[model samples]
Target: MTGLSPVFPEAVLWDMDGTLLDTEPIWDEAMDALAARHGVPMTPQLRRATLGNNSVDALTKVYDAARLPESGRDFDADEAWMVAMVVKLFARELPWRPGAVALLDLVAAAEIPMVLVTNTMREVADIAIETIGAHRFVATVCGDEVAVGKPAPDIYLRAAEIVGAAPGDCLAIEDSPTGAAAAHAAGVPNLVVPSQIPVAAASKRVFRQTLAGLTVDDLARLFAQARTDTPA
Candidate 1:
């Protein structure tokens, strides 16, 4: 894990899938179901490719792996089915990552604004917000709403905009390489706490095995060490 200072940022951007919630397994479940329908097992390589990908992108990877004729209609059916599966799972239970709630509480207490940045579509992102408690964030940026998805930084940049902060003034907490890369690309420093998938180290970010026991004091320190200036 990289070291950080004790200063809190002007705002914080949260990643939904693996960072705030333990929903990656639910996503994997949906993907596996899709693969089974195509007569293919959810192999390791295929699973890796889907990590941090938008839902449609994940389905496309499965389609390519199964060599299915990805007619538009066929893709729509599969995507809707996967979305339904995930919605059902969310209805059953909302799994929060360790310390996710506590960290959110801390941020809320500090009165610092936050934004949700996720690759999930808006409808599903709504479910996540409800389950996690909607009052925590000032804005939510979903995959379908952005021109590009994770690793492209469009969603994150939009999130920063929604929160009325420059990218350099926001702190992003992410759980995957794609989310981290997106935040980094948007000129936001991030704290990467890997969930089901591991995230690699990069400039202007910190990595941890988990967010357990993290406090505002810790975040302040991390932000202090993080670079505040983004290249133009």
Candidate 2:
């Protein structure tokens, strides 16, 4: 909280998994189970590679790591298994990242339009949204709905469109490098709050330790700083 008056962006684009929810460990657990099914261990490198990936891409990485032949792989079945596993785990509980609830509360109070942009498929994203309260967002753009997921800018672009905001007028809040890269590619400045992994500094990316006590004014300042720092 600051004395500075609030300066709101046209809209806010939010990353779901590692950003708003503490679901990375749940994904890791599911991935480990998937590896076991493949008769392979989920090594650290493999888990790292899968972070921030969509179900299909993450499965592909795991299969590649397992050294399984492409012809032997059953992607459709494996993807179903992975998503089911995660869904079951997600049903148990969806924890919020520190201060996430507060920030969402603040944003809602400000009456700022928010959109969820996630690499998670619609099936699972819908579940998470239910837990987070779907009414909070004007709309949601999932990986399955788009031709490609994060690191592609498609999801972010779509989210902005849904909010009726230009990319430059919106602020993207992300946790992973993959999500940050997508926001950057969309030419949308971001407030990066790294969750599971470190994100590299970029021209329009502002790093923060946590979202706790962050006021709308802080968001405005961060957005403005990113816009100014970004290369013309």
Candidate 3:
């Protein structure tokens, strides 16, 4: 078993996408299908731009890039379609990142108040929680549930509020630059686990660590060590 120093936070906030679930690949496939159906190229840059954004934000980015005629279309409809496609794809391939379940169980057993903070819609978030059996979270905050999404701090701040913890007292676990930035802006210390995107240097400097497959016991030990290591 790997050793952890036992550094614990009053509460923890989790990022949903690549961090907990290996849904990025499914997203890519669905995006490709959507682009093909719409006769628009799903370029690499376009995909990267939408990586950590909400469904509506991503669809807006795509719509702007493809220059599709408005057709008096409701943006929400396009977003719903994309989310529906993703839901169908994920139902067939319920992917979870390595160590996600173990880590979640460990934290839950420790009775650490946990909340899910994601750029996904509330509907998509619910599906993910059910798929991963992560419904134990005290609450879940989605981009669509907030006034703004990642890199805006609104979601993280709201999560902190719901958890009854100061942002500084909560630990935010993220895998994307946008999500990490959001946590940092909310005054929450973040731990990053790189996924579809690399953690930027600035984020690296601020994050507690780039996790390397930590278990619940490992986290408890880490928190203990952190307490000891922290200056009195």
Candidate 4:
């Protein structure tokens, strides 16, 4: 890894699912299996709409598509089922986004604090953190840990607080519109790295940069360049 200039932000906040781990497809496959078991057909459109949302939101989307009556039954049971399915799927394979670990380590080595800000529940986030061996990362703040999930500034703000950085001084790396919006609402500069799902045009306008395939070395170089351009 190339040495990056120390011009990086005081802290960096990360989005978990598509941003760090390639768990989106795993979620899709598990959801599909769940739908199949229930004799409901899962469609790509339905899956896409639920991208980046919490499990409850995703399950509600699936339930709506199947026209399942909103029975006052404990929906938490369904969430638990979904979580178990995801855990089983992950046991078979845990994919990480390219250069994710490298980039995170680069930032860490630069002495910049980092926190995971995810809409995933704390239990799920803990699993992911353990799978990724995320001890090197500073902290993780899950949606369940906050009052609200993404599209609201609460989670991001909580993450910033954990990292002890003001929103303006922190950079948020996100892969979805809802996540990007949350970062924007939190007043943090965002960088979008689009995944299998598309980002909205309105959301795209707020980001400081859009990366095609950023590597750890690339981020290091960016900071290095920034530092070089700064006057002594």
Instruction: Assess each prediction's global lDDT (C-alpha) against the native.
Output: 0.83, 0.88, 0.76, 0.73
Give the candidate order by descending lDDT: 2, 1, 3, 4
Evaluate residue 69 in candidate 2 and report its C-alpha lDDT on the 0 to 100 scale: 96
Per-residue lDDT of model 4, residues 16-94, tens digit only? 8888888888877887876775567878887777778776677777777777777833468888887787776777757
In model 1, how large is the Cα lDDT of residue 141? 82
The lDDT of model 2 is 0.88
The list of candidate 4 runs beyond 4 A from truth reads 1-7, 37-39, 202-232
RMSD of 4: 5.5
Tens-digit lDDT track of model 3 for 36-63: 7667889998888778887666777777
Judged by lDDT, which candidate is best? 2
Weakest 10 consecutive residues of candidate 3 by summed lDDT? 223-232
Q: Going through the candidates in order, what is the number of backbone clashes in each?
A: 8, 0, 13, 0
Model 2 compared with the native: what TM-score? 0.94
Candidate 2 vs candidate 4, lDDT winner: 2
Can you give the TM-score per candidate against the true fold? 0.91, 0.94, 0.83, 0.82
> What tens digits encode model 1's per-residue C-alpha lDDT throughout 1-232?
4574355788989999888999888888887888898888999889987888886678778778888774633867777887787888888687889989999999899888988889998877788889887778888889989998988889988988887888887889998878888888998998889887677667788766778898888887777666643323
Name the 10 consecutive residues with the lowest summed lDDT in model 4: 223-232
Model 1 poorest 10 in a row by lDDT? 223-232
Best by TM-score: 2
